[model samples]
Target: MADTTTGSTEQSTVPRWRIVGPGLVVAATGVGAADLVATLIAGQKFGYTLLWCVVVGCVMKIVLVEGAGRYSLATGRTIFEGWRSLGAWTTWYFGPYIVIWGFVYGAAAMAGTGLALAGLLGGLSVTWWGILSGLLGLVLVWSGRYGVFEKVLAAFVGIMFVTMVGAALLTLPNLGELLTGLAPRIPDGGLVNTLALAGGVGGTITLAAYGYWLREKGWDTPSYMRVMRIDNSVAYVVTGLFVLATLVVGAELLYSTSVAIESGDQGLVDLGVVLQDRYGEWAGKLFLLGFWAAAMSSLVGVWNGVSLMFADFMTNLRGGTSEDPDARAGGKWYKAYILWLTFPPMVMLFLGKPVWLILAYGVLGAFFMPFLAITLLWLLNTDRVPREWRNKLHSNVLMVLCALAFLALCVNEVRKAVVGA
Candidate 1:
């Protein structure tokens, strides 16, 4: 991998169209099974009425991610370094946040992958399949190189694109109604759901991993700025299409019916069954395959991207630069986080996620998007980023909108967590 510490002073001789590596990985990693389930539920509940929210959500992610990528390329500094520069509190928050977040997220990702697998090919229980999925991710990430990892993520994205989009097309949605959904309107009692669908589309802590992926892809300078923007925009466009397709499936398949899908990843399994009954075994199987791709892509993406972040965190905590060997992919700290994301979470699958851990995950997870949005608003506006590369007036407005949207989400999440506890 190229050194992430120093900006390449030399301009790239390569054409801009050729730059599409890390963005695809980050976008794919951001939209996992949970995102699919969320979109599907929105479609099921409100049909195409909230389709505009999906588009809005995609736009929000594009702005947020672009900010992150621009910070890295313009400053040639890791996001963690930028965060640490904010204050000692940033470190205090991120250290515990990552540890708890990874511990909970690993098991969840594994279970999600396993659920999809079990839905497609029966025999093993979801828990066992989840354990197996976790192990598979661990091995693949442990053994794979960054180039190979990107290729793997690309393959998963292909499968997701084809399967989910294909499934949506099969529904033969009403074009007029779909187009009308682009108009801003909310159904009765849809305020919360609308906010959620808009706020939650294609978001996760994985947003922070974009810069790390950029560094891994060797795009580490202001010369790569246009390419990074194009890459980010194109990737999110693909993501928006994928998410929109999922909504179409839900709207067409379940909107007229009284069927209710349970929440969480199992809701996807329920949707698969619905597809099987409504269409055929083949249709259901295809959806399950796409589900597996989505889950595994997240697994691999997190395994690589967030592990890179953790490595950097450890390096910075020790006063090492971003260029430290321990902070790069395949370094000891990087591998350590991969192991951390893979192994300890398996216990949660077998024994059930501890109640306290679930609560902590909820609270921490709630804070992250707001944390990211607020920090980006701060980082991109200051001298931390080059003036020319700083947030434009429109970019600041969108980012402020993003911050408010996510802060609302954070409040909702905290309320739900506390009430449920």
Candidate 2:
């Protein structure tokens, strides 16, 4: 494992193509089951009319993540460290948020993986499969080797790329309509859905994890900025393709057939069955395999990534800096959060989730993306980041739009949570 605090990979000399590790991790982690369903449902409802929003969403993520990576390399501080520099309020918000988010998200990720697996291998029920999935994720990330972790995630991305893109090709998308979808026009009554497709799908807390992965990969200094940008751009380009292919599948197959999938992760399992009925059992099975890969990639990525963030949070809160041994990969704090994300959530798999916790998770989780965007706008523009690395005019513009869009989405999320409660 590359030491997070020590070691160097020659940033300038390394070929451009080789600088593609961390971004893949973020992309795979961010575009999980819920994201897939959001895009899938969008395509089913509006066909390709919402395709432009997918492009907008990709650019928004790239901007925010690049700001995060740039701040890390330029200031040589973790994102949590940068946040702490602002005020004590940052600590108060993040400390509780990470705890609650991990508890609920753990069960959600596990159930998503279990759903796909249950459809594929029916011996175990979804609850048992979910427990098994959580255990497997725990084991895989326990080693805390970023290299091994990245490789495993890449393999999942390969499966996702092949299966998803193949399904899109199988549907034979109409070239004229596909091209026309590029024009930005909202269908009547699609405003909320458009906002969601633009800012919600393919986005998550993992965007801020880019810097942590970059550090683990030995790209901690400003010299790595060029490659960091390249890595982010290229990885999200592939992610953009993945999202587009998914929307293509929805538009061509589901829309044309007037078919609608059940919402949530189960929608994906339902799609697999549709593939089986439309094509063959093999097509459906392969799609389910892709679905599992997507879910597991997210599970493992968060297992590794957010645990790193939580380690930093704990270290900082305790007066230790980011370089503290407990804050680094495989350290005590890192492993502690991994346990938090894995084991406690199993109780929810069998016993129902407590209402108070769900309410907390919903309210807190709703604010995160907007919080991230607005904070990046504040952090990158300030003197904390080196002058050369501070956000440019266009970067600031995009981030402002990101902040506003996410704020709207956050309001919608909070409303749903409140209504459900």
Candidate 3:
């Protein structure tokens, strides 16, 4: 409830719209290739029936991300510092999770970016493209200024939204069926798939990265809370629309055709081929390009945003603060974590991820959202934040619901990974 935009000569001097900052970056970072593929698969199999899930996904993200930004502005503490205040249990879980998650995620994100590029430029190998994508992200982030990085990310997001959303418009699906998708109903064999699609859509560990980006944007106090909320709401509305477009395309074109999409990014490639063969090569090419933009933007977003999270993790774990020289963005610990996220993971690209490493990644990845929700539940309720800035009854209830929903999905994720179910 505090106004971070207060006590500012710049607020009166500068243009009001210029305040759009890290909220956009964080939202863009949250939607990657996997998310797009999930939407595409939902569209392909269920038509617009799963469109409601996209809406729910966007709402869930808004709650979690807004919570992140709120905590930072309210407490003037980094999420790392906030988590540590709760108890050692947070730091203990986060320490291993950050390291292991980074190692596995780097390779996966690079490959997704690479896949999109390879599809764009015909006959190129995915591995080389992946490396190129990774390098490009590294260079942009390494530049060390938040404004420059945010603008670059914003440009990529523009390309992705325009192209993908345009494709959906071209499909021209029936408005009646589209409206029906807004209803929350599940069909046969859809319980698990519905949950997965609902949970997976627009959800990622990157949700927690919002606060760090806010700090980088200098929206560090309660005055910017309203601005942050508006920014977050607008960004996710765009995201929800983009995902809805994918669902529309899937429902209109593939539902009755007996054309099944493969799981993961492969399904998107399948979509490209079908689009090209059926609608013309240009359609295929445009979708693939948009896909690349989505994938690469996410890669850069994660590489940049999550690196901030990991950096803060190390800094806070060692009891550092926002002012501690070693804890700052360009400081030793920050750069060190960035390196850990980038280089070591390249080994897995060649040698294949070890079974144990993959297991650890899956188990930890499964619980990350719930971990965030539960921690936010505790953090927001605690005396650390000013009483007025604390969560209202509605916010707490939504978070608790978000926590339970994600926890149930986490159990399912563990079961799937462990039992190969």
Question: Which 10-residue span in candidate 3 carries the lowest summed lDDT?
Answer: 1-10
Query: What is residue 211's positional error in candidate 3, in angstroms?
Result: 0.8
Q: Please give the lDDT score for candidate 2.
A: 0.89
- Over the stretch 1-421, how does candidate 1's per-residue lDDT look in tens digits? 1112232344356555557778889989988998888889999998999999988998999889998998998899999999988999999999999999999999999999999999899899998898888887777777537788889999999999999999999889989999999999989989888888887767578888999988888889888877787788899899999999999998988885757798899999999999889899999999999999999999989998899999999987998888999999888999999999988998888888888988999999999999999999899989988787888888899999999998998898999898992
Error of 3 at 102 (Å): 0.5
Q: Please give the range of 10 consecutive residues that has the lowest summed lDDT in model 1.
A: 1-10
User: Which residues of candidate 3, in runs, are more than 4 Å off?
Assistant: 1-14
Residue 92, candidate 2: how far off, in angstroms? 0.8
Against the hidden true structure, what lDDT does model 1 obtain?
0.88
Off by over 4 Å in 1: 1-12, 15-17
lDDT of 3 at 312: 75
Error of 2 at 189 (Å): 2.0
Candidate 1's clash total is: 0
Evaluate all candidate structures by whole-model CA lDDT and list the values in order: 0.88, 0.89, 0.79
Candidate number of the best lDDT: 2
**lDDT leaderboard ranking:** 2, 1, 3
Cα-based TM-score, every candidate: 0.96, 0.96, 0.95
